[model samples]
Target: MHTHGTETPVNAPSAEIPMTAHKTQAPTTDRSAELFEQAREVLAGGVSRNTLLRAPHPIYAERASGCRIVDVDGVERIDFANNMAALIHGHSHPAVTAAVTAQLEHGTAYTMATRAEIDYALQLRRRAPGFEKMRFMNSGTEAVMAAMKASRAYTGRHKIAKVEGTYHGGYDYAEVSQAPAPHNWGPAERPASVPLAKGTPESVLQEVVVLPYNDPEAAVAVLNEHRGEIACVVLDLMPHRLGLIPAKDAYVVALRDWTREDGALLVLDEVITFRTEVGGMQTRYGVSPDLTAMGKVIGGGLPVGALAGRAEVMEVFSAGAGGPRLPQSGTFSANPLTITAGAAAMKLYDAEAVARMNRLGTLARARIEEAIAVAGAPASVTGAGSMFRIHMKAEAPTDYRSSYPSAEEKALLSHFVDGLYDHGVMAIHTGAGALSTPMDEAVIDQLADAVLASLRKL
Candidate 1:
């Protein structure tokens, strides 16, 4: 079995050789399987998240540190998924671990606010001008929910608009049309508010106006139809499920203008893309949203989320006057452990760290592009700043509708991802990856070589 800090395993497949040149599967899964079987009796689907499930069974992790994770079978793979892009510094980062450990010794949570919260908020405010005032929540979903609700409260409107196929967590309104199919998705000009789950209230669907991504003109027309009723336009700059294609600058400008004209707010979902830039990807767009929902890296591998925005808009959550317009509170919100860990992580991920990581990201994408060309495979890569997704199409997709994969393509992607795992790389099943601070050119090269090998299989 390979130990934690080894350069690479003795028999690990090299980028120079074909993936099939060595053992293509984990040496042993008996322990992981045994634990999963026992878990099935208690936990739903033998795992806490559907994302953790695999073909035969889910692999159980024994431990992880830096950019590597060791499964129960003792297979150590370079972690590119990073817990679905949440771990900015990767698993068990020393600074975050030590900070959390220290906080644990003090206390976990309390009804009274901690100085840690104020200190962390100031750090964030200094990082992003959009974060004028902020409030912490337990998860990204909560942060998004708070943002949407706060928007409605601020605007006193019933309707909310969201780009088609962008995920903004599990909030009913926010999740509407997250994965609409051609059969149900109305038209390119004006998308129908498709419900993600069964029994989702029709009223909830009606209140959400779906805008086609990257189509500024169409989005404007759709928003015009709802004009005064829309509370805010919620968006993700680079939606992961949407093939990780970035929102066009024109599209963002259009939305910002329309929202302002319609007397509605513009909310940016920076949950996943926060790691893309020091101040979030919004900074790159040259747009400042009325509110920003944040998560993922901020928690430093712990559960955390935050909503920040223009003070006037965020004032709804405040009670300085007499019972504010919106009352928001979570028992674990801004708890010492999460704050300490997040502060340590964010402090380490300074401007220089962000620039270095993004440079590595650029190298990674360039290498993957080269691999795709060499394999002569119908594949493409899309992303910006430390994140990228491999699409099984020759051309990069322009929007969600175009990005939606065929059944065959889905199967092919799954097979390709599985191949990557067999080659000692754990990537997101969607063929997406978020680079972490610990990754360097060597790791990126390994990933590219794996891509080349996997594409050949296809």
Candidate 2:
């Protein structure tokens, strides 16, 4: 087993590759560049989301099958990112495609409820018993927004407490402190709620109580300090943006205890980590939250999100409820197509499949750690289940402050990721990867080899 350290590892003679010698040169993205140029004429910044912007340009995906995605250039690569860890079953799974096709035969959307929606909801409840009642939305951002609104209605409080450096969604309140720089990030014990976007109003920032992650005592103290004002404490068990660091069990326990004591709701944001287990990451921590926001894998590669929780708390969304009812509606909420695809995908992600994928992830992590040790690189892998992210540091980061990479480290990581792509492996520029149902031991080994080659190149 590889040991972690704070200082950079001493490079072995064989690993002493010059940084400039192996620096990744920009790829020939002729088609993608042309498309981007055309898109810029109409689309802002030539992309819909900032995340889609790559070094030269984003690769236009032509088609995907199993664990492979083919770009417009006709280059096929193993998909390790899997659409930001959303495609647990991988691209174009027969079950999901067939289900969606069948649903498409019937009308795509309807004002009335559909059988597929009810069926999918039932399946979700079975997997996550904490979801006594739930509502679907178009995306994770919407789900988180709904969760916060429900918490406010139930507790009659406007303020929300969230962990610093964790990403809940794009919603103004949830996005606070997602990427606080060292200068702006206050003390580790009590983090300041820094706005992620420029136009964010001071009022929105003030409503968020930022707490340090992994430090149970500090988080608990912050929660207690804002006891009466906070309606909910939103957190992701394994936040992707925070180097995929799993929340400490003690920290989670503290959150549960403090929220209960303070009459504040605990909301688990499992948008990316829901695939960690059949019962979700909450089951792994053995802590239940009042509400849970879910997305990614549950959507079956479709745009979907869900807010679920205790029946009493969720009753705020009910129409026949006596008190104030929190109205929730969306034209595409729980549409039949997404419902069918999601249900089919969920059915395939049985305990056996989940275990298989997680086992592959473990093997991949072990191999990557071995590569890091062999290359004597200042890097380590952090994550659980089928999700993993490589950090440009010797030690696994405990919190967001420690996780922040220096300019050199960031450049090196970007180059390394580009190398991986060139070697026929697709990973997020930030060095995150996710396993799919189609991945086996051999595929895991291949990915490990790709990581090794990429590290050596860097």
Candidate 3:
């Protein structure tokens, strides 16, 4: 089922992929299978969302603790998945718990106002200089949705340009190239926006224009081509769909300059990657964006997201602006508990702490790449600092087109991932995942050995 537009799978063999091994001893997840069967009778596809659905049966997780998940089947496994890279402190961090506990007694949500909300925003400002003003939201999806809307209002333009292969909360305008077939995504240079899931309205597609991620020339051409009509160019600071292809520094600088010169705003989705540094990767790259959509670790481990940007651009959210005010309302926006808990988490992530995490992440990636080489596998690792991905390809993918799985390759990866699972390294089936602070040399060595053994089977 591999096609021209599809990316190579992270774990898929390069060519003539072998058939999957036959069932051995009926596999071990009878209990999970029974639960999945029961869920299908009530829940759609035995799960709430597409991301949760996996091969055989989705594990019914009981509890998780720092880097480990105990599924209902009594299987204790390392959680490299980290709830899709949201749990930066791993599971149930004590500091986060203590902070959230006091705020819980105060309140969860109050449509009126609260002091905790201001503290959260102020703390974010302290961490990120670019965040002169910020507005809280419920999830990364909500933050990005608002970001797109805010961009349109601020720039008086309706169209949005997004990088191919980046996943930005699956909002209609941004999900065009996320893990989709080339047929649906259109051409290479001049891409057509195809809806990812069915519920997306055609109207959403009308405003989105897809751009090649690292191709600076194509980016300028697309920007110039779409010029006056493009509201904003939204991008993930770190590409998350395939390998963690961190956008090149110069490429990002080019986009910022081009967009500024063109009067169109630039939006950076730092949702999954904000915790890596005090100011996110934007500070590291010395590139500033018009607006930033943030989530993941911002609320500790709780569900939270925020839209941050320059005070000038965010002035529209003031009490009384000129035109119709774009309503930024969420039932749990800036709730006391999340705000308090998030502040604690961010404060705990000092420069030294950040450095330590980055060191571990860097070491882990190097070790894994070494393991791949030893196994005689064509592979590369990508990402920045403490956040990286194992790209089972000859080289790190410069763009999304080079990164992910083809249908046949995905079929091949089911076997590969099964071997990985059997070896004790848990990750998402999408062939992408990240590292966390809880992992040390021991954990890294275990993962390296696990990957090496899995490759031997291939």
TM-score for each of the candidates: 0.94, 0.93, 0.90
Report the poorest 10 consecutive residues by lDDT, candidate 2: 8-17
Q: Could you tell me how far off, in angstroms, the CA of residue 106 lies in candidate 3 after the best superposition?
A: 3.3
After superposition, the stretches of candidate 2 with alpha carbons farther than 4 Å from their true spots are: 1-29, 321-324
Q: Name the TM-score of candidate 1.
A: 0.94
Per-residue accuracy of model 3 over 1-458 as CA lDDT, tens digit each: 01112222221112321223322223465688889999999998789877878777787886776677766666666778888888776777666776888777876777778877887788889877789999988789988888888888888889988887778885777776665566666667876677778887888877778887777887788778777898888877787784677787778988898889888889999997786677888888877888999998888888889999999889767767565457677777887877887887777777766777777777777777887789887666777776767655767677777776566556655666666677777877755556665666677777777778877786
Model 1 lDDT tens row, 1-458: 11122133221212221112234475854787899889999998888898888877888887777778777777778899999999888877766777899889898898898899999999999988888999998899999999999998999997989989888888888889999999999888888889999989999998999998998998898898887899999999999998899889999999999888889999999999999889999998989999999999999889999999999999998787678899888889998888998898898888888887788788889988998999999989999999999999889888998889999888899889988887888899899999887776678878888898888987
Tens digit of per-residue lDDT, candidate 2, span 267-381: 9999998898997999888888999999889999899999989999999998774645688899999988888888888888888777777877887889889888888888999
Kindly report which residue stretches of model 1 are placed more than 4 angstroms away from their true locations once superposed: 1-25, 320-322
Candidate 2's TM-score: 0.93
lDDT of 1: 0.87
Model 1: per-residue Cα lDDT at residue 221 = 89
> Which candidate wins on lDDT?
1
Poorest 10 consecutive residues by lDDT, candidate 1: 10-19
Off by over 4 Å in 3: 1-29, 321-324
